[model samples]
Target: MLFSFSLPFFLSLFSAAQQGPAAAPARVQPSAKIEWRPDRPLTWEDFRSRPATDQLAALTSSSIDAKVGCVDYVFSAQVRAVFVPTESWVRDPKRATPQLLRHEQVHFDLTEVHARLLRQKLSLVKLDCEKLQPAFNNITKMAFLTWQREEARYDQETNHGLNLPRQQAWEQQTQQRLQQLEAFALK
Candidate 1:
């Protein structure tokens, strides 16, 4: 299973002040989600959650949400890359540097690249309802595994944004990948 950052219970309480008692009891308040965009980059202010550990400078909670549907035997899927601010946090805001923020942003960007890849793969799937769910599951599982591996490799190579040269190289490569997958970007 993917490492998810969603915390609906705490989020509901955190947002209780903003939402009155009239809020639906059965429905969990959705946490803050920011869709990946070329123009919008992450910042220290975007890290809203309290730090959970001193071991890491920062944590970026990003994932790709994929949905599939079938109508009249035609199957389709929609994929979105999202960053959850409520679940992302920094060990020390004052200590958080621009380089660190850029690194976190790259993580989100990588999620987008993976989302695009999932979308591209889903687009090519044959319209067979009998096999659609299994196909979707297999494709998404592979993508998620690949995404996690890439993330680990990036963090290791850049040393969590401490290595400026490696960080820059990753940033450049990520940008190129985003451009290459521009055709599959969320509309």
Candidate 2:
């Protein structure tokens, strides 16, 4: 009788021992849905043709709603060309082919979602205009920094040796600031 009672406890203990520290929490899925529209490709020409305000508006409106989070998110890419290492190295390394463009578009989509989330959180905080201004500025700066880091990382990893450590550091710092902003917003 005692053996039978001890068996279940022993098995429970064994199972607990077998399990490793809970797997590092699963990464948060990008809180956005990406939709690639082959018909509409954003080009330098396309961007240049529009007024600055219009360009910003277009970028903002490109986001689609996320089903899971009920939040607006954009995550799609439209590739126009490929990155040729030899040609890229000689001239403008910043130039992107269709595939790179697509990859970048996805990054933009994620950045947009992150920005939107931050904005929503800020509004929830209901700070006075004067008090909110600094926070808002910080959020904007952080978001841009994050976007630039992401873009540079993508470029470096995809292209040959475009490593910008300064950008990486900026990204890390901005991301940390963003987290603090998020926590503050939530409160």
Candidate 3:
């Protein structure tokens, strides 16, 4: 009787084992929905109508370094894309695709967010030039590094090369650095 009872238990266990572990609940990835405000797309005229000061402010505030007072700081829609000869071998320069524009726009937007956060931190900490200068320099460096990464990704995507690895590495590094900076700034 004991053997008979144990046999059924073993058989049930074996059957369950054959069925394998319960399936993991399906995971839904969040969608990245980018809303394009201008239906006509960004144009040279659109850039020119904006005040130079406002344009500089936008760029500077985005965590990008642009001398606001300088004439070169002006935004020009004509400058649709950025290219580096060193990475040209990996990407085609002739491919001035809309996706490239969108990629640059992401950089621009990220710069703005970084700049705003830095300023807020500076104010919160009551930092003077002497104290804030180093932090400012570090943030600038980080922005440039991020810019380079995005540019490389643009090239990779445009050339039909796999950039997932590079993108993931960048995302990890950026998140780590941002967290470190936030911690220091908060203190």
Which structure among the candidates has the greatest lDDT?
1
Candidate 1 per-residue lDDT, tens place, 13-125, comes to 01011111221112212476877888777776677788776566677888787778777776767788887888887666654556666778888888888889988887876
Q: List candidate 3 segments past 4 Å from native.
A: 1-63, 66-95, 128-187
Prediction 3 global C-alpha lDDT: 0.29
**TM-score, one value per model:** 0.82, 0.32, 0.29
What ranking of all candidate models by TM-score puts the best one first?
1, 2, 3
lDDT of 2 at 29: 23
Write one digit per residue (lDDT tens) for candidate 2, span 1-187. 0000000000000001111121112222233222323233333222212223311111212221221111133111111111111111111113323332333334333343344454454445443443444544465455445545654454445332123354354445545645554532212
RMSD of each: 9.7, 22.9, 25.3
Give all candidates' CA lDDT scores.
Answer: 0.70, 0.30, 0.29
User: Across residues 32-99, which tens digit of lDDT does each residue of candidate 3 receive?
Assistant: 11222212222111121222332111111122322211123321111011111111110222333333
Kindly report which residue stretches of model 2 are placed more than 4 angstroms away from their true locations once superposed. 1-97, 160-187
Candidate 1 regions off by >4 Å?
A: 1-30
* Candidate 2: residue 78 Cα off by (Å): 26
Q: Where is the poorest 10-residue window by lDDT in model 3?
A: 5-14
Ranking under lDDT, best-scoring first?
A: 1, 2, 3
- TM-score of the candidate numbered 1? 0.82
